[model samples]
Target chain A: MTTAADSTVQSAPVRPFAQALKDAQTRITTHMDARLGGDDALHAAMRYAVTGGKMLRGFLVLESARLHGVAEAATLEAALAIECIHAYSLVHDDLPCMDDDDLRRGQPTVHRKWDESMAVLAGDSLQTFAFELLADPRIGPHGLTLIRGLAQASGKDGMVSGQMLDIAAETATRPLDLEQITHLQNRKTGCLISWSATAGAVMAGADEAPLRRYADALGLAFQIADDILDVEGDAAKVGKAVRKDADAGKATFVSLLGLDAAKKRAKTLMEQACDALTPYGDAAETLKDTARFVISRDS
Target chain B: MTTAADSTVQSAPVRPFAQALKDAQTRITTHMDARLGGDDALHAAMRYAVTGGKMLRGFLVLESARLHGVAEAATLEAALAIECIHAYSLVHDDLPCMDDDDLRRGQPTVHRKWDESMAVLAGDSLQTFAFELLADPRIGPHGLTLIRGLAQASGKDGMVSGQMLDIAAETATRPLDLEQITHLQNRKTGCLISWSATAGAVMAGADEAPLRRYADALGLAFQIADDILDVEGDAAKVGKAVRKDADAGKATFVSLLGLDAAKKRAKTLMEQACDALTPYGDAAETLKDTARFVISRDS
Candidate 1:
């Protein structure tokens, strides 16, 4: 059945921020379904793992694309690509050798629901699918830029580096300091967010400086919010275990800056993110609100 | 540090198959080294995992690209991309949850050398790097075609599917038949090999039908030879534990067809592979030699 979010996007623009996000989620999810559709068990596992997320990364893609006046067809593909990347990361992160989580988004992790081998293959394939989506000819010549940027952001120097640091910290004699934690968060979470936010400018061959600036602040704020939520969120609502970082004595924005300071900093960065969109003026309304929502989100 | 393989490619046409294979290995390894030169431990792991293989898949790409008159620089990048993909698969396959092999290429597997988590991330990152390499603009508009094909060949319906079936076979009540085994090997081993063989044609936008025909037969023969090697080859020379498939009671080509019949089938397919190269004639002498080498190699 079609969701309200799906209909809202189909109807047209200027929806409320929450509605707009839901719309992007619905649209991207549908696109993903089309891309991943098959009766095979592998496809089932892929779809199951991809669903239930808020699609925040995808919304960032759509908003950025919309702001740049990129056509929805191609924009949707880019959105799907980012979401696939995000989803693949989560699936792999939840594997037995990684975070070892049993539950994610209120459901059993892929390895928990299927076997670890299947989880590994499913995660592997999902990642390949993300690149497949980007390689679509409709993404145009500049799509190569998006594809390359994504590889950098999601691969070694970005998310993977962040994850390695986090894993190393677990066995370290000393706790990671504020700078280290910031670096980690920037890669683990911020890289993809920044990529998502700047995608519109990249595809349009427009100045990416503004979007890059906006995403730089927005990504850090988003992480700070995540740190704040870990300390404050209820498992029933958050759909995953919280306070694990604190319990593990891992350095986090909250642990390093303290909850109050972290919250204050997130607010400041949120404002900075909003300010960065000034060049686009009224055209960036959705992005401006997205910055606010990053901090305000409960899940 | 340069091996005989390095000198063969640099020198010129009509090197012996052994030297041609070595040259492809040396060139591809150098490219991979340059591409993976970060000081980070992840890079170290990526490099280590990518090294020491026979580089047969890479040889296929370079030889095929060479046959198509594609530039060496662009062909080398594609070769590196496939090697990265191959290395990633091996790393993940050697993980505790997958094939669980402790030795690969006569050395400790990545997980054994480092840890399971690092192996996972290293493998994950290597796979990402493959796409990144293909996305290089030097691959040009055809890069998209290569990227898309790589994704298909390496993702669900290709290599991963073959792996899933292999894992599933471990617990099945009935052993897979010859047809099922062929199907499994086709995806598991054939897909990427076929992609490697056909890459030159894809890059040139030339007719790929003949190469496709050659790869289809050659891939099966390669697997049958591998099966024969598992039963008859030495672990020291083969660079990994041999006879494990037979010991596990797996329904390999050798198991279903008998060693002699499997060998005969491989020879038949090898001839078919050579015959398919008739269109390119002498221009494809190197590839024809590769088909012969596939059935004759020790590892």
Candidate 2:
């Protein structure tokens, strides 16, 4: 029996993954620039923080929204909101008090560019901006649901919780075991990805389970790929200090599972991710390409 | 002539300011304790950061809501939400990169109690939690309005913008002039207070002009009073360091206007605050009492 997914696959022409990703990045930046038009130093820093990222999470939002027939305007807002959140996390994580990285997205980090105080305020403002963007009336009736979901995915029990666990592990007497590492990664990176993937369904008021399953597998694959890149990729290609995780003796997937096994695991998970998108059939081809790119890209 | 304001004042029996303040404090704390039940370090720091404040903002929300006949349960959530935002600001402002205060509300600040990373995460979480609370269905149909208002009030253009100006002023060649200082104070502290006071009107879809007028006067008076307290308040009573602004040679109402003139100005503003609440009449007795307390409280 032909399913709705099969019909959608046949009817919807697939856009190239790279073009789709580029479109999301351009649209989100334009939207952000329009909203954050102040000439103040704070606005400048906020704009700086959100620039030059991969916009993969945002692409996920736009693509998923397209699959679910959510309005493009609302989807674009959600996409930009997630980008703000992602950028804020990066800014804070690069703080001297946290990871203390000097570089992000091939530029001096927010703190290094200005001062730590500016970085803190910029990050803080960006987080608030994310929620503000979601509260826009264009987001339709599901605005509150989207707001609550983003809060849950990024706040204490989700991204922040993951960050705390990672910090605690840094000083622990013993390295984290596989299970602990998985839990940490899930919280630290997985939660936001899951939220982004499932957001379209939430917006469309459709079932989110398939997207959730797709995201869970995809998020782990993404992280495992990150580990592989940390060990094997060039610093310039990765756009950050590679081998730092190993240098810090951090118990990443590669460290725990061995590089070869980790790569295999990421591959298997990427396949699982693609399989989970069967409901969207060929309409989800770009998403399938995204899953492949997550494991394959250097950055 | 009988007006709605006059009738409301006559019909609504006045509750004692202290008793109403205490009730708001109790309800907000109870709600917060229930919501923040996790035993993790992040939760612990969040709970700690929110504790021991005067709960003045929360009280303002509850009182404003009461005047408009908004549901008590929903009002309580907004009350707690504002408190969370207030506490988060305090926590972040006290970081080493910012104001660097060690003591807050007669207790060690979050960074001193835990570490900088934890403080950052906790503050970040609290901010997100504030938005999350406001997104609750319990907050009724005006939830989106409240969320948008809050984001506008506290984000880059509001509280954070004020903070940036204050920091910039610290290093400027000359102390801020009266006009510049007023602008800074308006953004830093005035915006949130205005949002809180007018929340009832927003929620009830009533006119917010009177409350906005009351809050504008009250917020300015509140800042002037803070300047006075900085000069005259004992550290013990104030619950934090006093006279730092003078020592640092930071421009303040007390410094610019002289202590006596500043006191006079605060008193005049307080009266203005009270007068603006005439529409609410006796129903606003507690709020008028609050206005009086703003310039009079030692802390």
lDDT (tens digit, per residue) of candidate 2 on B139-196: 9999999999999999999999999999999999999999999999999999999999
lDDT of 1 by residue, B248-282 (tens): 99999989888788877887898888889999967
TM-score of each: 0.94, 0.95
How good is the docking of model 1, by CAPRI class?
Answer: medium
lDDT of 2 by residue, A180-221 (tens): 999999999999999899889999999999999999999999
What TM-score would you give candidate 1 relative to the actual structure?
A: 0.94
User: Clashes in model 2: which pairs?
Assistant: B9-B282
lDDT accuracy of residue B5 in candidate 1: 30
Report, for candidate 2, the interface RMSD: 0.4
Off by over 4 Å in 1: A1-15, B1-15
* Model 1 chain A lowest lDDT segment of ten: A1-10
